[model samples]
Target: MTEREPDSPVAEPATALGRMTPVDLSHPLEPGMTVWPGHPRFEHELLQCYTRGDASRHHRIALGEHTGTHLDAPVRFVPGGADIARTPLRALTGRAAVLRGPAGDTEVTPAALAEFEAAYGPVRPGDFALVDCGWAGRWNTSASLEPWPYVSVELAAALLEREVRMFAVDTPSPDPSDSRACPVHRLLLGADALIGENFTHIDRLTG
Candidate 1:
């Protein structure tokens, strides 16, 4: 088990005059939810059910850490990096920018990221930079498992230059599926930056 710090207090989101517009960025996790190949699939079993004459209901759930909409900590790729328990919550909560890529591409390059900046200003420090590659539409299908959009090492370097709080993607892994060396994961997470993967509904945020 990893040694962890005490839980920190989390502040509630600010509502405008008690009204809040919430955007759900996560995919629902079910018994048959899609998972990365070679990873255990999500499973759920009922421990107690009202239909079975039980007064209350409960369930036993099992899933990998990377299942569904999830965040990856530095410990995922870097030695001696912060684990989920040690990662600060504030790093995952902040202003987020949705960067759209050109249609029909499997790789987001440094030049595309530069184009994004040219249009929406530089990705400011402390922002969550989400790359939208139109891949979320392929969620849960075999096609999603195919070579999906991923960030190039150069783009990873540029994102690191911006000191982003978190980097998010709509695919399973930001690095190539067959990569023996995951340089992007190491570069970002090793710097204590967070990573959100398998994100859905990112296209809804893109202009």
Candidate 2:
């Protein structure tokens, strides 16, 4: 994963509040939205609205496949995976616990997992895992998501064995840059664990 140009413009100026508002983590899927080498290009067009004799109304919009803050069902990656429409309501409902970890820490090891679990409480059979890697600050640019952070194979298996439902990270992607195959993805997503990356301002958990 390489850095792409800051092709999209975000909301004008950051909020003045000491508390930060959520800046959108999704890239604007216009003619831009840097994709993998073979992904389809984003499209757009202008469709005119009702026109009067002297003037005409204007409407601009575009259509896309899973555009912006999209949900990718397992079927997206796995063959004959579950479709978004087919997803059960129970699969979407759960209790979210907010946990805080060290700053700049990557690769949440098995030992670290135990430390967190012990501090917060026992790891239930269906708890969600959130790793605050402080990676959200870089979401406005591409460099942030390129080199990501995540759980190791051992920890991944531990989570799976423990029946963890999902895992999310404040970082961009989970897995080292050097590896061609995304093992973290294979280990977690393959097991049907939801992974939410590029999560921003997770420090609010202290609240």
Candidate 3:
């Protein structure tokens, strides 16, 4: 913006921010946020806001899964776990394959993955495999999150056996039911494989 002449209102300078497309894969965390049973209740409070006459409009949110683009640390499974920040950034950020496999089929059994390997060759190490069970279309509310999709124990081992450095899914979780007891999580996390969940915008990557 150009500066105003004397006796005119001052104008702010134009910013040089470039435009970039955003693919949001995180759930918005709120007080009534939907989470797996027995986890932490998602919450956020706007302590102050610029419009509210505060220094700035900033809110503090607290929840588990942190409900969006997040990582499952190795220590979350192991005793005295490593937490999220300790892992390498390279592990979470990289080239990924948005594989379109079965849908409405939460538990990705071993048989379901056989054709994937046959079609794409072996999934190598250090590759980010974003498995889409077609659950992206159902992310409007918490009910959809529960019944979406998940990876089975066998499939978890299969991905591990295939040497996938990181495996992520679009569903809010990697299990089928609330009381599934996280068998799939244990299988994958216990083996030290990086896991990512609660991802949206998975459909955009299909084409």
Candidate 4:
């Protein structure tokens, strides 16, 4: 028999098999879901259904790009900046470092971040720095109307210094709900970093 050729090289998996746990970090999109004031509301309309004698069933959905758990692209706050389409996929997916935040409307400060690092570990470069403020539990409740927790500009700067790929929160925004300046949005987007808002089930990440 002729000698067999060497086996073709196989690509390594992105992460060690059986060592990864999947977590649902998003809220379900449905009609009348909690949304930012004055933003487009999520709508799902049936275009065809079995009841209507249609061959197939489908729906028409409409909502603003910022609706539900979503990422804020550089162009959202920065003029002439990169849009979501231009954002690299590597920036969106990565090892995440979940930092616990205080309840209510307290602002996350650099000192708070330092305190977390003192216990768990440092927030490494390129990691998704997700701040779990326990605000997601108030989704669609009267408490949601209250000002949610936010990240301070100083903390934003600290995160940037650490070279984080993404700054995410379990609240409506990194800035306060009543914020007019939106400094955190501007600062993070200005650096081409991503901002994830309205994330849920972040508490599951810690365990």
TM-scores for every candidate against the unseen true structure: 0.86, 0.64, 0.73, 0.89
lDDT of 4 at 29: 91
Tens-digit lDDT track for model 4 on 1-207? 565467965445765545777888999998998777789999999999888999989999999999989999899989899999988776677778778888987988887788778888888898878899999889877677689888999999998999997989989899988889999999999998999998999999861
Query: Roughly what TM-score does model 4 have, to 2 decimal places?
Result: 0.89
Tens digit of per-residue lDDT, candidate 3, span 30-80: 577556667787778889998889988887877765455577877766777
Residue 35 of model 4 has an lDDT of 79
Preferred candidate (TM-score higher): 2 or 3: 3
lDDT-sorted candidate list, best first: 4, 1, 3, 2
Candidate 3 residue 206 Cα shift, in angstroms, is 3.9
- Candidate 2: regions farther than 4 A off: 1-72, 98-105
Q: By descending TM-score, how would the candidates be arranged?
A: 4, 1, 3, 2
lDDT tens string, model 1, 15-114? 4424745678888998877788788989898999989999999999988899989999988988888899987666667777787755454678888777
How many residue pairs clash (N, CA or C atoms closer than 3 angstroms) in each of the candidate models, in the order given? 0, 0, 7, 0
In candidate 4 the C-alpha lDDT for residue 157 amounts to 95
Candidate 2 lDDT over 9-43, as tens digits, reads: 44553443435554343445556654333445556
Q: How much is 203 displaced in model 1, in angstroms? A: 1.0
With candidate 2 superimposed using the best TM-score fit, by how many Å does residue 195's alpha carbon deviate from the native? 2.2
The candidate maximizing lDDT is 4
lDDT of 2: 0.60
Itemize residue pairs with steric clashes in candidate 2. none
